[model samples]
Target: MIPAINIDAALAALTDHWSPKVVARVNDQYVKVAKLKGEFVWHRHDDEDELFQVVRGRLRLQFEDGGETVLEPGELCVIPRGVMHRPVAEEECAILLVETVTTKHTGDVETPRSRSIAEQLA
Candidate 1:
């Protein structure tokens, strides 16, 4: 039998902010967890949509269109492919993400906070 994963335990093991760790896989997608604080770079995935779910604290997604959405714990948002967005948190926040295996952590732009697939898998 496949062992169940303890999300809290997985989250606790993370020591870096803005870095995502892969926790599971579903077909062509990856389920990841990340601890984030401060603002992230603006980027867009041309072909893969991304899903963001707040696990703790809060998250604010700022869109290139000048619109923004704030998500509290248990809340989730689906970012359509090709829509530019940046994620920001006033304090440390935990989040779960679902994205295609081909999706880039920073989408179209690479920043200092970006994490590669290999890094995330490791």
Candidate 2:
């Protein structure tokens, strides 16, 4: 049976900055939420594409190729596998991330700034 998803209930569970809260799963994918501020690390997933949806804030995704896109509330974007991208925000914002179970939030590039994918899944 498919689990019911209550957006309000899910959003209520999130209470940290940049820490993702997993709320739903579809196949090998997870629907995750987090509060973003400042900047994230540049990373890439070799085998999974990622989707980013802004729920209550704005975010800017910077690509290694020197291009970037700002995702406003209600807008979303997909980041392809093996591409380097970093998420940045000017202030506190809510965001939902969708990706395969194997996809890392920080991709292959690890740094102190990288939020552990496992931790987020929990």
Candidate 3:
């Protein structure tokens, strides 16, 4: 049986800015939290969808066609696989990510800014 966990407590343990400290896991998927700012690399996942939620501050997702959506705190969006999108933050923003085990944070756009960690906890 899996033990209960306090996500708020786990979120507090993270200190490194922009790094997603794994908070928990749901089966083969990982739940992570991170602080983001400025423009991020454009990328796409060929297999799995990417879930993004703005827990605080504001975030914008830019698509290849130049379309975008701004997500304020409490808003969430899921970018389907193979869709090119870039995450942008006007200021320090807290975000929650739900992704599969093998999903790369930046997907196909490999970059130095990708959040690193083997997997998260539950």
Candidate 4:
């Protein structure tokens, strides 16, 4: 039987930045939550689109083309596949991520901040 998942509680369980926790799976996608504060690496997924939904505070998605989008609570934006993006949070922020099950945390770029699927599910 599937149990109810609490976004807040799952978010509270996360203690790292840029590390996303897999909370649920729907079809071919994974639902994840993360806490952001500072800047993430600029990377792009060659085969999948990613969605970021702000749960609290704010987030800024910067693109390689110098374009940027600021997201407030309840706001969401989809970063098209293969587009380079760097996520930034001036202050502490909580967010939900929706992406394909095979999507990497930092796209094709690997940093110290990257977390594996096993780690996220654990």
Best by TM-score: 1
Question: lDDT score, residue 79, model 4?
Answer: 92
Task: In candidate 3, list every pair of residues with a backbone clash.
Answer: 24-121
Q: Is candidate 1 or candidate 4 better by TM-score?
A: 1
C-alpha lDDT of residue 23 in model 2: 86
Error of 3 at 43 (Å): 0.8
State the lDDT of candidate 1 residue by residue for 12-95, as single tens digits. 999999999999999999999999999999999999999999999999999998999999999999999999999999999999
Using lDDT as the yardstick, the better of models 3 and 4 is 4
Rate residue 34 of model 2 by lDDT: 82
Evaluate residue 32 in candidate 2 and report its C-alpha lDDT on the 0 to 100 scale: 90
Q: Quick one: ranking by lDDT, best first? A: 1, 4, 2, 3
Q: Report lDDT (CA) for all predictions.
A: 0.96, 0.84, 0.81, 0.94
List RMSD in Å for every model shown: 0.6, 1.8, 2.4, 0.8
Q: Which sections of candidate 1 miss by over 4 Å?
A: none
Model 4 per-residue lDDT tens digits across residues 14-89: 8988889899999999999999999999999999999999999999999999999999999999999999999999
Q: In angstroms, how far off is 87's CA in candidate 1? A: 0.2
Each prediction's number of clashing residue pairs: 0, 0, 1, 0
Model 2: lDDT equals 0.84
Q: Give the RMSD in angstroms, all C-alphas superposed, for model 4.
A: 0.8
TM-scores for every candidate against the unseen true structure: 0.98, 0.88, 0.86, 0.97
lDDT of 1 at 90: 95
